[model samples]
Target: MAYCGNIRQEGCGKLERREKYRLFLYVLLIGSITALFICWMILIWEKIPGAIHIRAGIRQDLDLNVPVSGKLYKAPAETEDGAIPVTGMNAAVDAREAKTLSVDLAEPLTLYAEDIETYTMDLKLFGLIPFKTVNVQVINDKTLIPAGIPIGIYVKTEGILVIATGDFTGDDGQAKEPVGHLLKEGDYILKVNGREVEGKAAFMRQIEESNGEELVLTILREDQEFDLKVRPERNQDGEYKLGIWIRDNAQGVGTLTYLDENNSFGALGHGINDMDTATLMNLKNGSLYTTEIVSITKGENGTPGELTGVIDYKESNKMGTIEANTVEGIFGELNESAASHITTQAMPIGLKQEVDLGPAQILCSVGGAPQLYDVKITSVHLDHDNINRGIELQITDKTLLETTGGIVQGMSGSPIIQDGKLIGAVTHVLVQDPTRGFGIFIENMLIQ
Candidate 1:
C-alpha cells in the first residue's frame, strides 16, 4: 500500500512539471512575436523621409492685359425659347431636302478680351464663367484717352555716357560728310566740350555751341583719362546732333526676397529686366530697401495682376547689388550686414528628386500679412527635362487658395518644403488652373 501511494505522488509531480514547461513555451512564443512587431515598426520609422527647409524671398512681376466683360446666352431648351440653328440634314433624309434644323447649343463659346463693351449678364442662366463671344458695336471713343498723352513712364539716367557721330544731312539739302572721329564704345563721357555738365540740359547746350565744329570731349575709358574730338551734324530742325545716349548713376531701393541662413545672404530669386530691350538688366550696384505694402490688386478671371508699394529708403539700408543670377535664382555677396539669425549649420537643400506626394507648407507675406498654411504635394515628376518647371504642386491649403487664389503675383520665389528639406522655389502659377505651378529645384539654385 505504501509503495502504491509513493508512485501516485511521483506521477502527480511529473504532471505538474509538464504543465509548467508548456506554459513557459507559450509565453516565449508570444514574446518573440511582440519583439518582431516592434522591430518592424522601428525600421519603418527610420525609412520615412525628412523635410527640406529653405529661406525664400518674394518677387513681383507685372503683367498688363486689357480687361473686357461679356454676357452668356444659354441654348434653348425643348420646351423653352426659340429654335436652335443647325446645318446639314439627318442621315436618313435626302441630300436635296437637307435644310437648316434646330439643335441645342449647350456648350459655351468665348469672345476675345477686346470685343466686349459693358458687363451685363444673367447670373441665373450663364453662371460665373466669363463670356467668350458677344455681340458689340465698335465706337471711336476719343474720351477714353487724351489726344497726345504718354502711356508708360520714360526711364531716365545720368550714369556712364556713350557718344557716336555719323554722316547726317542738313536742312539746306547738303550731304554732310562723316567728318567726326568715332568715340570708342567704352568711352565714359564726363564733361562735354570742356564744360562741367550736371544734367541733360547742360550737355545739350555744349553740343549746340559746337554746331558742326570739331569739339573736344573729356572721357574715362577703361579707367584711363582721355579726350576725343568729334564734329556734330545739323538735323532737319537745325538741332546739333552728336547721336550719343547718356546715363547717370542710378540709386534706388527694392524688396529682399530671401536670406540663405546657411550661407548668410540671398536676394531676388530672378533677374530684373530692362524695359526697353526686355532683357535681363545687368546691375552695376543696387541697394535693398524695406517696403511697406499699401494695397494689393487681385487678379481676375482673365486679367493680370500687380502689387503697388512705395520704397522706404530712409528706413531701409543697402544690402548689396546682385552679383549674378544662375539657373537657381539670384546670388550676391554681402558687404554690409548679414542676416541676424543666419547660421552656418549645413541644412538640407532638398532635391526635387526626393519629393513625394504628401503634405507640405509655404511661407509668404501676402498683402503685407505674413501667414503659414497647410498644403499638399500632389504629384512629383522625376527625370524631367525642364527642371525649373519640374515638380507639379497643388495648393491644398483652403485658406491660402481662398485669399490669394492659389499663387498670386508677388508669391514667386516662395520656398517649397517637404520632410524638413528645401525642395524648390516657386517660379510661376498656371493661369487657367491657379492651384498648379512650377518650382525650380534648390539644387539648381545652389549651382552658382
Candidate 2:
C-alpha cells in the first residue's frame, strides 16, 4: 500500500511540473512578440520622411515714381488765425507750355496746407498768357506747417547734386575733403537756413548770396527730419557748387517670372538703380505695372537670371503696383485691365490632393531662367514640411537642370505640372542638396 501511495505522489508531481513548463513557454512567446513590435516601431520612427525645402525668385515689370524737390508756398489760413489764406497746393505743370510756377511761403510756422480750401496761383509768362498755375491751400488754426514745406513744380531737369562733407571717398577710391554735403540721389532738401526757398532758382539765389558760407539744410531722410550744415565749395570755374545731379524720370519693365504658390504675385527679381549715382534707388513711393511675357534670358552657373519684356500699358489700366516688398515678395491688387483669361482662371493655393512619383513639368520661357523641363518625381512623402522633406524630384530632364543648376534663381513662381494638373509652385532650392528642393502647396497661395 505504501509503494502504491508513493507512486501516485510521484505521478502527481510530474504532472504539476509539466503544467509549469507549458505556462513558461506561453509567456516566452508573448514576450518575444512584444519585443519584436517595439523594434519595428523604432525602425519606422527613424525612417519617416522629413519636410520639403524650396527657393523661389520672382520678377515683375515695375514703374517707380521718383520724388523730386518741388517748391515751398505760403498756404492760406482757413480760420481767423495769422495763417496765410492760400489755395491749390498740388504738384502741377502747364499743360500747354510745360512751364513750372514757383510760389514762396511768406509764413514760417506752417508745415503744409489743408486739402479743402486750396487755390491756384496764376503766373504770367512774358507778361501775357498765364503759363502755369500754382496749387495753394490754407491751414487750420490749430495746425502749423512745420519749418519746411515741400512745394511741387515742373521743370526740365537733368541730374541731382550729391553733397557730402567731412572725410569722404570718391568713386575713384581716393579720399578727398568734401565741401558741404550736397544733395544725394535720395535726399529731399527742405529749406536753406531759416529762409523758405520756392524753387531751384530761389535755392540757387540763396546759395549765391550766402557767399560760400556754411549753410543749414533741413533734409528729410526716411520719414524723420534732420538738419545738416553744408558749406559750398568753389569749383574750377570759380562758381560755388554742390556735388548733385538732377533726374527727370525713369521707365522700365520686366517679366512676371515667378509666382509663389503660397502668395499671389511677386516682382523685381532684383532691385532698381539710381542712374545718376549708380546705386540702388532709395525707394519712397513706387508702383508695379503688368506686362506680357515677351521673352526670358536663361541663367547659367555663376550668371544671374533676367526677364525681358515690354510694359503692358493697356493692361496697366487694370494693373496695380505694390506698396512694399519687405515681406514675402510684394502684394498688390489687380487692375480691371488684367488679362481677363488669366485673371478669370482659378489659382492653386495649397497642397495638392495627390502628387504622383512619376513625371512633371514646369512652365517657363526660353532665354528665361526658369525653363519648363521634364523631371521625375522620385518619391512623394505622405506628410512633411521641413526643408529636407516634401517631394523628391530627379533631374530626368538632364538638359534643363544642367543648363540651370536643377532649379535656378527667378524660377520661384514657376508652375509645377503633374498628371495634367497644377500641383504647387517651386519655393526654395537646397544649396547643399541641389537635387532636392521645396514647394508650397498651390492651395496655400490662394488663401491670400
Candidate 3:
C-alpha cells in the first residue's frame, strides 16, 4: 500500500510541471506580439503628415496609408464661420489603391481626426493603440481677384523698428552699446518710459525726455512683448540716443491678385521680407493705395528687374487697409473704388491636382496696362522648398517677352489663368533663363 501511494504522488508532481510549462509558452507569445505591435505603431507615426490642406468640395489623395486592420474616425466640433476650413476624410479600403487614406469634401468644412486603430478582436487593443493628431484645412476652391492693378503697400511695424544696431561712444569713458541685449535688428521699440511709442520720432522723443535716466522700454520682438530698462547716453553731438537705426514704415509696389465678393483682396504671391534684415515684415497697421506705373526695368539673363510706380496715398485713392502679410500674399479689405480696377469676374480657383503641364496665360501690368500673355508650363514640381513653386513656366507670348524679356520683378503677383479658371500666380523668375519662372498655385493663395 505504501509503494502505490508514492507512485500516485510522483504522477501528480509531473502533471503540475507540465501545466507550468504551458503557461510560460502562452505568456511568451503574447509578449512577443505586443512588442511587434509597438514597432508598427512607431513606423506609422513617422509617416503621417503634420497637417493636410485641401479645397472645399474637392478630393485630396493623401500620400499616406493605414494598416490593413486599422480604421479612421473624425471628431466633429464647432468652427467659426468664414474661418479657414480643413478636415480629414473617413478611412475605407480604397477600391483603386487598396487600404490607403484619402480626403473628399462635399462642402466647405473642417474636420479633425485622431488617426487611431480600435481593435477589439481577441486582444482588445482599443485605447492602447497610438495615434497621430491631424488638422485638416479646407478653403474656398474658387474666387475672383484683380489682376495687373498695382497696389501701394504701406506697412508699419508695432513700433519704431530697429533697422540695425551699432556701437557708440557715450559720455562715459568706456565704450558701450546701451541698446545691447535689450535691442537688436528687427526688434521693435514699442515704448519708452511707459509712453506708447508710435513711430521713429516718437521713440526718439521719449528717449530724449528720459533725461539720461534708466528708461523703461517696452519692446516687441517676434510677437513677444517684454520690458527692458536702459540708460540713454549722450553722444559727442550732445543728443541722447539708443545707438540704433530705426524705421517707421516700409513701402513697395505689388500687383493685386484678387478682389473677392467679400471685398477681401490678395496680392504679392509672397510676403514682403525686409531687404536689410531678410525677415518677414510684421504688420501693425498699413494702407494699400492705388499705384500708377512710372517705369519698368526689363528682365534679362543673370539679372532681375522691377517696375517703378507712384502710389496714390491720397484718402480718395486709398484702395484698402493692409491686414495680413503672408507667404502666399498680402490680404485685406478693399474700398469701393478698388472694385472698379478689376473687371475679371470672380472665377473658380484650380487645385494643385487640376494644374496640368500645358498652355496657360497670365494677366500682368508689364507696361502700365494689364494684358493677356501666353506661357507654357515646362514642368510641375512637387514642392521641396519653402516657397510654393507649383509649376515651371516659360514665356511664350511675344508681347510679354519683347516688352519685359519675360517675367520681371513687378510681375510677381500676376495671376495665371487657365481653362477659364485661376490656376496660379507668378512668384519668381529664373536669372539663368529670362523666359522661365515659378508660380504658386491659386488654391495656396486662397487659403492664405
The parts of candidate 1 lying over 4 Å away from their true place are 1-258, 261-263, 319-321, 333-338, 341-347, 375-387
lDDT computed for candidate 2: 0.44
Stretches of candidate 3 exceeding 4 Å from the true structure: 1-141, 171-174
* Local distance difference test scores for all models: 0.47, 0.44, 0.71
Alpha-carbon shift of residue 160 in model 3 (angstroms): 2.0
Clashes of each: 23, 78, 12
Best by TM-score: 3
86-192 in candidate 1: lDDT tens per residue?
Answer: 12221121244232122112322222222212221221112233323321211121100000100011122323454343456776777664334556544566666
State the weakest 10-residue window (summed lDDT) of model 2. 143-152
Top of the candidates by lDDT: 3
* Ranking according to TM-score, highest score first: 3, 1, 2
**lDDT per residue (tens digit) for residues 130-164 in model 2:** 33334443322211000000001111222222333
